[model samples]
Target: MSDTAIRVTGRCRCEKNPVRFEYTKVPAEVHYCLCTDCTDISGGAMALIAVVERSTFRITQGESKIHNYDTKPTCHRRFCSECGCHMFLYVDAFPEHLLIHVPTLDRGQDIGAKPDRYVFVNSKLAWLTLPDDGLPRHQGWANSGAPVEV
Candidate 1:
């Protein structure tokens, strides 16, 4: 990946937001989460997340359209009130990081990083079969490249 600074743009489905933002650098980590907290919130089978520094994320547009929901207690998911699509989340458990949903990025934008691991696999849907991508699998999150033993 290029060491040059890369800015990423993300938005909701309303087509009213360009929610421009910068990532200073590439993401610290990326992964697929099968946790119910993620799936249930996004209404998806799983979530592809990029853990980025909070200092690097900036909201450039449609600020008023963004709304926050305290999915649990300290977990906050921010979405567009119009389209109800989640763009990013702030987890108190990992305060320094903003977990961004990769799909929100502008079309054809290079992510510069790929999912390095699969997490919360223990809770993964029974019908889903993981590919042999050679990445580590974790039953839970260790917040690093390391996998947790469930």
Candidate 2:
């Protein structure tokens, strides 16, 4: 991947509001999640998240419309309340960073980099079909990876 930092911009489903963010550095990790909670909340088969430093992201506009939901003790999801668009997530493990949903970002950005692994495959719906490519698949969080530090 090019070392050049990528700029991503997005807005709440309402065109009136906009959010801008840039990654000062490449994300430490990026992946697709097939967990039931993600599917249920986003109404999608999977969610693509880019792990980035909290400081690298900002709400350039409409901060008041940002809403949060603590679905679990450690999982906190954020969305645009005005149009009900799930945008990002914050987990207790990575208090200093935010996970941005790739789809929520501006279109034409190169986020197609396939996920390095599949998470929560055990709960994945039977009707869904993940590609045969040999990406590491996990039942839940990958404990083998280094802990995210603040």
Candidate 3:
């Protein structure tokens, strides 16, 4: 990671009108999530999320235009109301982290880490074949050799 803060922002699909936000500093890691909650809420086979410290994220613009929904009792997802772009989410499992959808980052910005792993493989869509990449695939969260299970 570089000493300079890594910043990113993005708009909804309608490039004409957009809701934007920006964040700084390096993210912990990026991961591909295939959990049902992710797929259902994002309306996609998988969702790519950059996990950054919550305190480092902020809505620089369109604060009033963003809306949220609790996909589950413990998961609060935020999106642009107009274009309906899923932006970020706060998960109870990791309260200190903000899960920013990779698609929401400005096109030219450096999004920090490449995906280090694929998560929730057990729930991946039946028709979707994961790439033959070498990244670790975890049924749940990666163990990271942590003594305490998350």
Q: How many pairs in model 1 have backbone atoms within 3 A of each other, for residues 3 or more apart or on separate chains, i.e. clashes?
A: 0
lDDT of 1 by residue, 1-150 (tens): 557468777777775454555576678889899989999888888899998889878887788888899989988999888888889999888889999999888878877688898888878988877787788888878454566433
Q: Per-residue CA lDDT of candidate 2, range 31-105, in tens?
A: 777788788888888887887778767777778888899888899998888888888889888888888887887
Give the TM-score of each candidate. 0.88, 0.83, 0.87
Collision count for each candidate, in order = 0, 0, 0
| Weakest ten-residue segment in model 3 by summed lDDT | 141-150
What tens-digit string does per-residue lDDT give for candidate 3 at 17-124?
A: 577777787888899998999999888999999999888888777678788999899999988888888889999889899998998787876776688888888787
Residue 78 displacement in candidate 1 (angstroms) = 0.2
The residue pairs in collision within model 3 are: none
Runs in model 1 deviating more than 4 A are: 1-4, 144-150
| lDDT on C-alpha atoms for all candidate structures | 0.81, 0.73, 0.81
For candidate 2, list the clashing residue pairs, or say none. none
Q: lDDT of model 3 at residue 124?
A: 77
Better-scoring candidate (TM-score), 1 or 2: 1
